[model samples]
Target: MSTLYLLHKPYRMLSQFTDKQGRATLADVITVPDVYAAGRLDYDSEGLLLLSDDGELIHRISHPRHKQPKTYWVQVEGDISEAALKSLRQGITLKDGPTQPAKARQIAPPASAPRQPPIDPKRHPSTSWLELTISEGRNRQVRRMTAHVGFPTLRLIRTAIGPWQLDGLAPGEWRTETLHAPRPTDKHPNRRKAPRKDQRARPAAKHRKP
Candidate 1:
């Protein structure tokens, strides 16, 4: 049985346990030994972050190939247009490459926890909320995608990652849960083996240097 921690990472804090730049880190919040963050969030971003002692579980959660869905509450500047929402659903190209299609929709402002310092509304007088769910973990992908469609992300908070949700966790709080999901192994279970008949090769090709 592996232990997993559901942490509510506060805004402007690093996902790591230690930081050389004197910025706040998980050490300031969580004290569990031997548990490392399964995936990470940007220093400016907030919300659900998972930590686990199981490397396989971490790999399963973080690897893009797994296509584990992660959903966020995005606050973007200006009213997000339907055209933008359509493009987000269909997918958009970023500097790295094209992003996978995502679930994006305009939503009423979520009654989320207030930021530590609180976001300044004056910087962007007009803003709206969006619920965006994506499977790929690209560098600043949600922000880039929204910007490409003419709306820049003002704030981001991951609400859920696969089966884990941020529900009931306040800022700087954490809860532990033991996960038992078929016990992932390091072996490649999907590799195909050569057929027995194919393994028996011909003596030689007919026209070779006999």
Candidate 2:
């Protein structure tokens, strides 16, 4: 059986479990043995991060080819123009290549906890909130894409990944969920295979920081 954990990652913390430089990381908060992050979130970004001891689940969640949707609540430095919003929805070209079309729209600010060190309005332009969802996972893709459309992202917080959501977990807090078997997806061609008894879920220990 695998243990799945949802972590509400805080801003400025590394996605990795360890850091030789001694910056905060999963190890600093989570004591779970053998669990690993399913994807990478930038140190500057915050929000939902999934962890699992099952390698297969990890692959399904992290692989861009699987096309799992990732949703973010972004605060950008400007009153985003309709043109920019349209550009984001239509897919903008980046240094890497043309990104896949994304679901994006202006939104009211989310009710999230105040960041430890608040974002400085002086250094940033007047900002607006946006809900952006992408099916591809790329290095700093949200930040890069927003910048490309002339509305630089001042803060990025992922709200959900695939079928899972943050579900109100506070910063540095974590909760566990169980997956009885791998849910069938387009990537799984052999859907007829029976799930192994060992693949069942179990209650996982909670890990949170004060």
Candidate 3:
């Protein structure tokens, strides 16, 4: 059986287990071994992060092609207009590539606990909060998407990832959950089948020229 951990990562903590500068990491909080993060959360962002001991489970959870929804509570620098929300839903093009169409909507203020250091006050006397849910997990994606639409995000907190949520978990805390075997219909057709358990654990190394 595989082990799945749902971690509520606090702001300013590295996602990986190790940091050369002695910053906080999962290793500092989680005592489990051989578990790896399914996806990444930026050091400045706070919220749910999933980890698992099974490599196949990791890929299934975080791979963009799987189309798992990730919901973020974003506080932006200016009042978000209806046009901005529409643009986000239609999908804003980023420098790297066009984002997949997303579900963007203004939300009532969330009931999350206060951050240790609150978001900075807007210099221009404008700010708003909105909820954004996207299936793709691009690097700093929620921040970039909002900025592209002229409402730069001031603070970002991920509220959920797929079926997992940050409901009872507090900042910097973690809990484990049992994941059921994927049903035949639940698996993504595009994803290649994972190697059998008896196969070599390591993926084939790619050759790079010096």
> lDDT per model, in order?
0.80, 0.81, 0.77
Clashes of each: 0, 0, 0
Tens-digit lDDT track of model 2 for 29-123: 66666677877688899999887777677776666667889999999998988899899999999999999999999999899888878989888
- For model 2, name the residue pairs that clash: none
Taking all chains together, each candidate's TM-score versus the true structure is 0.86, 0.87, 0.83
Of candidates 3 and 2, the better by lDDT: 2
Q: How well does candidate 3 score on lDDT at residue 179?
A: 62
Output the lDDT of residue 170, model 1: 86
Instruction: Compute the lDDT for candidate 3.
Output: 0.77
- Among the numbered candidates, top TM-score falls to 2
Winner of 1 and 3 under TM-score: 1
Ranking by TM-score: 2, 1, 3
Model 3 deviation from native, Cα RMSD in Å: 8.0
Q: How does residue 114 of candidate 1 score in lDDT?
A: 83
- Candidate 3 residue-wise lDDT, 32-121, digit = tens: 656678777998898898876676777777666677899999988878999999999898789999988888888877887787777655
In candidate 3, list every pair of residues with a backbone clash. Answer: none
Could you tell which candidate, 1 or 2, scores higher by lDDT?
Answer: 2
lDDT of 3 at 209: 16
